[model samples]
Target chain A: MAEYVRLKPEPGRTVSDQLYQLGLEFPCGGCSACGGCRVRLVDGEIPITEGMREALREDELAAGWRLACQADAAVPVTLDIEQWSARILTDNTSVAFEPGEGFGAVMDLGTTTLVVELVDLATGDIRGVLAGLNPQGRHGSDVMSRIEFDLREPGVLCEHIRGALGAMLAEVAQGREVKEVLLCGNTAMHHLFCGESVEPLSHVPFSSPALGARTFAGSELGWKAEVVTFLPCVGGFVGSDLLAGLVACGMAESAEVMALMDLGTNGEIALGGRDGILCASTAAGPAFEGGRIRMGMRAGDGAIDRVEATEADAMRCHVLGGGEARGICGSGLVDAAAVGLALGMIAVSGRLNNAPLRLDGAVQLSQADIRELQLAKGAIAAGLEILRRQLPVEPDVVRTIHLAGAFGNYVRVESARRIGLLPSWKAPVAPVGNSAVRGARLLLLNPSRREAMIEAALRRTRHVDLGGDAEFQEAFIENMRFMPPGR
Target chain B: MADLETLRQAIIDGDAKTAGAVAREAVAAEMDALTVIQQYMVPAMDEVGRRYECEEFFVPELLLSARAMKAALEPIRPLLAASGAKPAGKVVIGTVKGDLHDIGKNLVASLLEGGGFEVIDLGADVSPQKFIDAVQSTGANIVALSALLTVTMPSIKMTIEALKAAGVRDKVKVMVGGAPLTQQFADQVGADAYSENATAAVTAARRLVAAG
Candidate 1:
């Protein structure tokens, strides 16, 4: 074949027309939401097309960055680039929490969402609770996208996240006299709060500078609280959230093997036993938070709480807050996937059955929806499989499967196991709603708990890069089959 | 004598074996290979590309057609080579530093290669110096950079600056793609092209080569 350099015809073909002809599949329909089209200039100065100038920054333009899907190869050019992956931390040291008399607050700053709780330091009672989407989500749905924005424009990220937390705290406090504050978040979040650069967090052999927890004055974060403590990060991907969950669930108390999973935007899993604890985090992406999916939404009012499909192609849904269905939440999605598989509305490979589901409104799960659910479930299951492979005994040896997080609280445990999202074992599954918040609250209530949490964090060993595990990929493919292995 | 109509129909049917046999017969009858390609194979591939763009055909279909086109072109390789027909352009592609994901990058490479670009893939977690070296060694006119993480985007800018420092900034066009990059960010990083997907990358590369 004549290696014809498919060049843009000057004064003849537009970049868009050429791209369309090239058969490019643009996810997001080029809505400019995801930055999947970024490209760079390598040879001979090519003028920044209007779209390039609009999508990128001046520094980026000066640095030869462009969106490959948007940029026209009409001009002479050479481009070098690759795909980026999310990084997780594994090592963490114990932190000390000193509780004082008076009202205090605990916060869990998650990638997709943020939650805050007001606590009475003397009694450990939660006064009020508030949850909302991370304001920085407007930049990108996931941590990687947010980090990308931060890299392009310095300082904006820290300010944006801090502002969001400040607003959330103000709402959750609601006239309470908040004296101290305790924060639990992933390593990237901690770094952003401390005004530390996240450059290292995204590189190979990812490491977080803050291994143990640290106490800072509330004034440091422009707050009036007397004390502010940032919980120590466990590892790059495994953050205080998992540690806090472990503490709240009392995973270290019993000698029996226990598996603790904090399922959110990032799925962090830690399996503990008499020998030691092994943990890993998976970039489950933002499917839980409804980022990439077509009809996904957060666990909020008006979101679908449950779904069931019947043999007659009939679909039923339960809405949260007894209102019209806005979208499907994470819990509802899990249920729908399991139920759909059970009812034969979806095939094992996550393909929607040829028979279309009929619902009251526009609440049917499409083929794409099933695929997205499969991906999310695959990642979680794969993480568990990786932990099992590293364990000495069989998965059944694990005594308990503690499900942490708000979404975990509502998920159907049986459905989760039915879909192979969790290990098929006789171990008890307990739902600890917002364990990170609870652990943070405990730290605020009892100063002694900080030492225990810190010890647990330090004693834990983190498993790196679930993506590299061949077992994870295998599990992902198998789990994507939606149906039971024997079936 | 067989006209372009009959040959075009054969190409459209994806009859690579028959197309090759016909092309060989035509050449033996003193017909031009370029005429056969421009009049038949390219048009057929264009149809396949169109079907792909319309979603009527998926990756498997596209791959099949591309294979067919390759098979048909095999018999005319000597004629094109003897004519010293140069590729439309050359590109070096890789994932940015700190990133090991390559599914998207691999897809883009496949589409670009199918589009007839001489692509030198650098795989994943490629450093700025590696990109420069690839560009220098391959004499590629375009550099396609992919990053799936926001944390590694700084490396993209650094690579661009490295190319400039090597005093070869004006010698090639740089393109960037991934889940976090935007056209605006691409411009800020000084990239010449920003495609949203693999198919678009091929289109963009072709345009860049043609513009040159």
Candidate 2:
């Protein structure tokens, strides 16, 4: 499904700006610092700048590959747009709801991806769905960078995301009478959406002043809806998405102690039950999403999405598209690390016995890649440990561990435990796919009790600031090893 | 004297309690503090650095060794000062402004201290003026800058420019390191050196001091 686009650059704007209008992603904030926005010139010519020269190899330059961030095409030019279409996890849980009139839209505004679902309120039937890369990625991929961008050019990122989501909601509504819209995102996304100052989130302790739930008249957002509501966040780093995840996982009603983990660049973890909950967010880095690894990528075609070890200690990689393995994704990375440990190619210290263990043709797991995983998983495991200590129950009393997000849904529980990414508690781990959307849908269906549930969840949860926590620091250092849980 | 071999092994094994005990015994015995550090402690750290470079040790191990070295150095630091012995070098370090992530920067600081540099850690979200004032007040010969986020990286360049504007750019060497940083980026931002990890950071700082 390859496509091409012909673009005429507007004055005072780079080609990346035009591409962003075309719903393209600039993973590096269009800074020309990364090669993620590279586009192949199919016809005509565009002047190359120093950024293009530095980012592209000689052969790539010879083949007309150019970084769109640095190019401002004066003449109309055709360019190949590869890696544009991406599959976002949109599976939702089926829950009974009290049917009402009109329609409602639910949105899960993630840092890297965005998913919106249109549903009939009366019958609780889904109408349409739209999922794609969040256009604000052109600003920055992570929340910290997005905060910095907003600090410089206030309201620019807000305009970008609001406009994008507004258009999407309108498209999903399709001129139907949409009564209300509900959204859930991280603290940064919530602040950006509300045009609130992100300065508080840019420092240690990361407590934001504007982290409360907000309701907006659809007229303000230029949507033909009655009202729009953003769910409230738990803490500075622990977002409303996790709160929605708690609702989706039925943690608020369960009397038994439980845990919910959404693993990503920002590893959000919660431990507790109806009595109380402790939530903390750890900077897990980009290793899980394949950002810092040498040859890591998203779970897509040609990407090694899974890895297994044979009895003879040989690795068997399963590519996403059943082709040659191009790179390893987060799930595959976890599995490979586990298999490497099983075969003695990796030590408990995460040291590779032989550096760059080849998993497939030209697809190898380097020593540094293993270190990245170690740091990422270590932060997550440490966060969980810290939260577990704060709970009233014993460590072994965690009845269930609900893994949220796409990474949690896809990563094997055994490999995660082997690498100490998940704890050794006997609680059966369950993958809860896209719980934020599911929770938002439930809230949309039960508008009468939505406010009460939000109040209850807020009252039952306490924010744990892991920054500068001595216990967390010690646990992080101790958990950085690759030893199996309970070791 | 204090069975310095045990002290050295304690540091290598990252046994902070044993390292601290041995160093305290050495201090009580009036063993020359400089001799203890140069002969036993620095070699242990060097071995740690070597292991880190060769991939035998990771960040946790490196951090543990640094902690053990810190514990061992505690009782000896006052003795060395009383003996009028000089430190290897004076370095000023901080995470650049608007960047709160400091784990990597802290590791680099610890390793630098273990490597025998007199480090003045200004902590995270450090403004350019703070760095300049610290250099002026402490007379630090080297400035280490770190930033973890891509958006906060330009502050490293701004700090360099501020150092130039303050007319102290030529007085001290500028070193930079972070997750989103590269050698090319360091050079682009006018940093004199870029180290990939904590051990490399110590080596770079030492090299910068030696070159001057």
Candidate 3:
């Protein structure tokens, strides 16, 4: 079954085209290969292609189901479209900033998703929130891939991202004047958006020296905002998003030992508080983002968000939207792996005891999937472990793990620790949802905080070269064992 | 004296300490270091490489076995040098510039060392000049290039061009391997071979040496 949305009737426009224009995330990126953009026709004659007939069942075809990627809108039709609710992390943190004249906008331009929040600065109220799959995704999924694409075709990335942000602004702004807009993203996204070449980011001694703040006018990016500001990037893969995360966590202000981990496709880990900061980006791959998994899908309706292993060794899945299981997302993947461990269904060496294990009779977990998860979790854990060694304070002395980003917000603490994705500690983990966006919002509300953040980012934070850390390699190998640390 | 079968089994089991102990015991029993490596250690690692190719052993298992062979080879290095014994081949390995990812490079180095190759590991983010310098200084038979990121994959060609400019391109066989590399890329970059993984890297290195 395909998800459908009822848009204001267009005489000749297709349902899929309308959704794509509205920024609905088609996982395959405007391709018909995955069939993720299927829509069910509620009323009117929508022509379905031969390819759709081959992929869809007879009952589905009879019930007016059509592949959105292939269907055309010939008449005014109300089709059931898959609604999107991008789980963006935006929890306010650090010192509050002063209101800047009129309404403001804050954006977190993640590699996969673009989340924008409209705020009324005068009233201190969030006017509206809008999110969509990054149209820049048509270029590539990860930073490295995006860099490669940028190197190949110079100007396309900036155009795509800027256009997508423009559409999003048009939707959420609702004719209201936004005084300023602030963006926080990884180094690649930041460079691509500002039309900076990524050639410097791709080779030896990899980093651009000129990663300071930049401001643009409304005419520049085709937006109504008076000014748009992008935060500074901290060398290597740890972009402005991480710097924003630091601002959100207030690493420079407090003497108390604290660590902030923004878990995502890249899994940037930073540790230390007052003495100094040791930060590194772990190439955790796309496992946690449901990349390269057998039945992996982005977190959305029908995606299995949670998994439980019954005492009888049965797999129970809790899907989003309370429907039949479609595919497992990141949180569910971790829970299933942890549950498999508890039941001895997966060996400590990351070999699944069961072959092609059926889950909820709708999904399957393969041995390769377990290994992918292990590799991903191991990289994150090893990165943290390496950061610990470089810090002046003992790792045990550090308290309050600030888990940033969406994956951090949703993943169970016990499961994360058990899987070694998060370092094993008794200290409370503060899941600061979307600290990047929150930090950007804070900066947007108060321009003064930007200087403070820049100062803090420059003086206090030190980028640890994990690529040179031998302890990291050892930690990575040792952590490859699926069991928790010291087991 | 450490029994030959027991030594081989120790290496196969990935027991580095036991493999080292057995190799030392064998040397103490009036056996030649080179002879011990040829009779037991190399054969064990070769079996592991074969198993990896056959899908009997995956990455973790293969890496473990490589570590065991490396440990066993450590005690014999001094003796091999004192006796003027030469390794199977000399391998110059490093992850290309702009790519800090060394896991693949390190794995290939470990596997090559286990296969009785003298590996000069340049580590990650090595420049083209550095790779050429290592090849010149070590007189390496093969230079294995690794790049995990697609953005950095072009370094393979740059390194190859450097090798040619130094008039040593033909002297050393170039083998490239990484997540995003392929045979077409290897051909385009003028590398002699392209390996899909560490185990295959060792095989390609051995084949390159043999062909030259």
Candidate 4:
């Protein structure tokens, strides 16, 4: 899950300072904890500090392993960045759209990742794709952290993300004229990118006044597109990404009630049909995406992406690129937890019988890791339950569930059900990859559908604030147990 | 005596139904309700706290034990109050303004209650004025503030400033605790003390009340 990069460190700046622009992640916020920002001295010397001694083992230090946040290279050096070549989900489903004039671009600006795709506006064809870790990650990993970061240093994240995304847009529109550009992200990203205040979002009853659609001339954002627009957000934590997901899945225009869930750090859920749409956001921490767990990383080279209980007593794992497993990602974590539950290695109470169930080389599920997943999956499960009760029809009327986002798309439905992460609904579950970008692509191709769909989404959607809900507490605690679905 | 012992074990095991049943049996038998809570339930919660501190239990286990202790205390509450048993102390508690997270705050409140404190829980997103008002009205000597987010950590200081503004700063001991909190932060915010976790919060509250 690492790649080498040559850098000439500034005399005073640390290694994190010089390489942060390269989307290098410091999962522990570069506090020299977690040892996640480790870099090997490929060609030059990195002086080992006390932090390296504490975080790295004896053999690891002897092999030139150093914490990037602690050590700096005096001269030009090639150091291997541990979190590189991330597998961002850009494979979107096809949609019919009205032909437009020329080329266009669509971007799904996530809190952790950025994806930009160039599209042939007249033919509905994807020309090129560019994806990277959102550089704002260096500030903080989640939305709440980003808000806190922005509160301290106002508008820095905004300017940083805008600059990063503008570069992506420019690269996506290389020389060829892009008629217009469409972008969609969660409410935090939407607000940060549009230069709106995150003050209201940082408090109780978290909703913002500036969630409406924002438009700017492409040149104004240092890009060459004719028009650039970031989509509007639904109320509360339900961001425009879920709105775009609704559009992509055609939920609001459907006959039967369906559910769309984007299981990111902020797990957003929407339930409705042609009648109406109900959305609520649950603070599902980054457990699903391998945040906070020891030996956790993004789905990249050498990350364990899948796991299975081959027999009752044995476990097996599949790494991403067929090498030694450096870390485990969300999908693999779900599978491991499910497998643990099946084998009775992990109790329903999230206790590890043999504490720290080793999955692959250096990757193990600790007791704390199980608790984190419980908290995360509990939030999502409870959110779904709360939204289901509010539906006009029967509680079990949801016919299908459209699992959006990379985690949802890549996660195994059977494993999710086994751990009660997903309910045992009598319906088909479909993982529509990158629905936000696909919805944005739809809007880019057919501008005529934009105003009406946005209006409908705004008018018909009811945001349920889980914080204020009375039943939410009980539901969340109950869902925290890793029971079989429907039990 | 056997019922009280069963209640104690049930609380430690996080068996709410068993704890509640034992508590009801003790109440029906007219056992001293205050003695049941002061000696058994409190000690049971302390054992749960010890287990949590040593990593033998996690948050779920702590919360489960809290819930069970709450169940055991339910039927004993009225009897203890009717007998005119004074609580250890009155404490006002809430998550600070701009922070909606209340799980950790609720845990502290539950543990405080189990420790025989008359907890006036104001819930999350509580403003500074609310704390001052609770202190003035309830005559509570301790105010506990919780903030989960780093952005809302300043609210703890602001709440303290409001207490000072209202001229009740000296009258009440302010305690702060959360995930991102530290002793340095408590000192910076002019708090009387800072506890790292819910169990320590009980000890801190007891010390703060005992100091006066």
User: What TM-score would each prediction reach against the true structure?
Assistant: 0.67, 0.80, 0.83, 0.84
| Model 4 regions more than 4 Å off | A1-96, A392-395, B82-84
Per-residue accuracy of model 2 over A410-439 as CA lDDT, tens digit each: 788999999999988889998776778777
Number of the top lDDT candidate: 2
RMSD of each: 20.5, 12.7, 8.8, 10.8
Compared with the true structure, the alpha-carbon lDDT of candidate 2 equals: 0.84
Which docking category, incorrect, acceptable, medium or high, applies to candidate 2?
Answer: acceptable
TM-score of chain A of 3: 0.79
Query: What tens-digit string does per-residue lDDT give for candidate 1 at B1-212?
Result: 44556555555555666666676776677677667776676667667667556444433345445555666666676787687776567889998888776756866775565455667999888998999888888899999999877677778999999999998888999889997789999999999999876667777887888787
Error of 2 at B98 (Å): 5.4
Please state the error at residue B206 of candidate 3 in Å: 2.5
What is the C-alpha lDDT profile of model 1 across A208-246, one tens digit per residue?
A: 565667777767777656787888787867888887777
Number of backbone clashes in candidate 2:
0
The lDDT values for all models are 0.68, 0.84, 0.78, 0.83
| Candidate 3 local lDDT, B1-212, one digit each (tens) | 67878889988888888888888887787679887888888889889888666545556677788888888888788888999988889999999887878877888898889888999999888899998899888898898999987888888899899999999998998999999999999999888999997888878888988898
Residue A407 C-alpha lDDT in model 1: 65
- B173: Cα error in model 3, Å: 2.3
DockQ: which candidate is best?
3
Question: Could you give the candidate ranking by lDDT, starting with the highest?
Answer: 2, 4, 3, 1
Please give the ranking of all candidate structures by DockQ, highest first, separated by commas.
3, 4, 2, 1
Chain A TM-score of model 2 comes to 0.80
